[model samples]
Target: MSELFPDGDEARTLARLHERLARAADRDALLDVGYRLVDSPVGPLLLAATEAGLVRVAFDGEVREDEVLQELAEQVGARVLAAPRRLDRAAAELEEYFAGRRRRFDVALDLRLARGFRRAVVEHLADIGYGRTASYSEVASLAGSPRAVRAVGTACALNPLPVVLPCHRVVRADGSLGQYAGGPERKRALLDLEQH
Candidate 1:
């Protein structure tokens, strides 16, 4: 959590950039697609939104940013842009979370990118809560298939929303951090942030 708050001019610059991006993103409301890269304690994150609500999120090192963006355009729409306005509320909420000032997120979500069992898993993920961890089998059971533990991992790996969905709370039955889309270290970091 220590990394959440950046002091001095850097923090101020980030705030200004966020504001400017949000305004710029707001410039084209008709496009229905807005996205921005946000700085965080973990690293840079790609945040994207739609008219429906917050959509996809990608970690800087986990996924190829360009491929993810292109896929977003092909999957959601073609009018996507690096617009911060669409991401303002989500970004603010995330900042607060990293600062250990927030537990649950209150942003609208666009879940069209996920479907079927994976969608169910994502929804169940939200119930895990901050500072709490659940086993893969447990979550799989909650998703209605106790035997689908492996599938739970896959869903988490492909999770369109990470921090917002709180997939980091999922763990191995042995109480170890499993494979995370953002890698195990980040998973540990998020878990540590909450646990402490």
Candidate 2:
């Protein structure tokens, strides 16, 4: 049996515990505030979120820092800070990975932005093994929704984990590299990194 807190407080504690458990069940469900900005081959990628966890990861070409952070504040219920260290380790790993000195990411990931089918798809993508590629259809099947090819695509589009989740590993069934939220050139570069 679980240890109980002081009488009346026990019920409240149970409720809080249940809420946290529910959030854990949903990968995209987080409740924290954090921020990260890292350099990428494409340029700087800025990320921000509430304590519930990371809520935004925007490309350099897409500049909407204030609006994005403000929105994250409203959604995650916390003020946003400009702490790049939240992703510093991720940035370092990415730098090494991109430089061909690393393989896997060893950084904390705030996956609260991905939920439901999208969360499932992202999780499955994360398991796609390095240097390997899978078709959209294959990933959809792995996500337990074999016919959700389009949905899988949407999930890839929304993936916050990017290189960690390896959305670039997802390709068209016809052997064509498909569109990437980060862009095709980056996708090509990432795939080449894995291939060679």
Candidate 3:
């Protein structure tokens, strides 16, 4: 046995208990939201999903784990759990993306976190294409609000799904990197990754 669990039986019992709890939750439809932490080139990322699809992706430095969970509980549902299995597909797709093996994310997305024009802006970001960029004004125009340049920036800032949605592909009119939800450095890193 390991030091933490001197008796192997205790570890096994705990594992079984957790398994039972997960099964029971699923069976009873109590698992409203499931989440897991994934390591990436930038930093640790929190991935949350619901029955509909992948919901939120948060950066560790930008948001606290507990805060993310609390927000999900309030905005989504209170039956959130550390259910890694539920987010396996999202985690794998992210891994493939960071490794440059994948250019598009096929995972279903629950964009309830954003609404109205913000949702429209983020949804349009996916069309920016891999390794290509669009100016905020261009994105605003594409999103059908030609004059809402600042609104486009706000939409990117509040995008619930960052890398997957390719919000980092949006830049300034002069081709300068702008503010990002994951910070400027991370945005630069993502752009750099795509360039190569």
Candidate 4:
């Protein structure tokens, strides 16, 4: 009687319900889209995936959760569900990253949200490596357009996948953190976490 939940019935009920839902989701035949909200050192992240791969990763409060899901529903398919199993590998890898156990992600990525120059920019950004910082101009040059530095900045801003692609590793020519999809402080933390 001295506890907030004295009987512990609520906890048991929730665990049982989670099991049922996980089982049911596993049984669903046409589950083309799966999503889950996972916690990160920066904040909560909304991860969504399709049969193709990890489609979107959104930071908590960066955008409304429903808006992120609705965008996925429109971009991928309408069969999205809050299924954690599908995102288990992604969650594990992200956990490893935050723990500093992983320098690179092994999860498959779906870059359908980005195409053309942005896609090229994102791909190049991934190669910038762990603890390495590349300037916008350098990224643009590597992406095959030295004069498209501004476009490179745009690409990073709209990067569908942040930590996985290492977009936070890109910085201003003066070594400033510049803009980040997950905000500047999060970017700084990721960089600091990586450099150490």
The 10-residue segment of model 4 with minimum total lDDT is 22-31
TM-score of each: 0.86, 0.74, 0.91, 0.87
Q: Please state the error at residue 127 of candidate 1 in Å.
A: 1.1
lDDT comparing candidate 3 with the true structure:
0.93
The TM-score obtained by model 4 is: 0.87
Sorted by TM-score, highest first, which candidate order results? 3, 4, 1, 2
Candidate 4 ranges with C-alpha deviation above 4 Å: 1-29
- Model 2 per-residue lDDT tens digits across residues 30-123: 4355566777776777766444434466776654667656666775655455555455565677788778888776655667778999998987
Off by over 4 Å in 2: 1-32, 49-56
Instruction: Report lDDT per candidate.
Output: 0.89, 0.74, 0.93, 0.89
Q: Model 3 over residues 36-145: C-alpha lDDT tens digits? A: 89999999999999889999999998989999999999999999988888888999999999999999999999999989999999999999999999999999999999
Clash counts for all predictions: 3, 10, 0, 0
Q: Which candidate leads the pack in lDDT?
A: 3
- Residue-by-residue lDDT tens digits, candidate 1, 1-196: 9889767698789878866765765764655578889999999999999988999989998878899889998999887767776788999999999999999999999999989999999999988978999999999999999999999999999999999998999999899888898989999999999986
Best by TM-score: 3
Q: Candidate 4, residues 90-152: lDDT per residue as tens digits?
A: 999999999999999899998999999999999898889899999999999999999999999
Model 3: weakest 10-residue lDDT segment is 1-10
lDDT comparing candidate 4 with the true structure: 0.89
Candidate 2 at residue 175, lDDT? 88
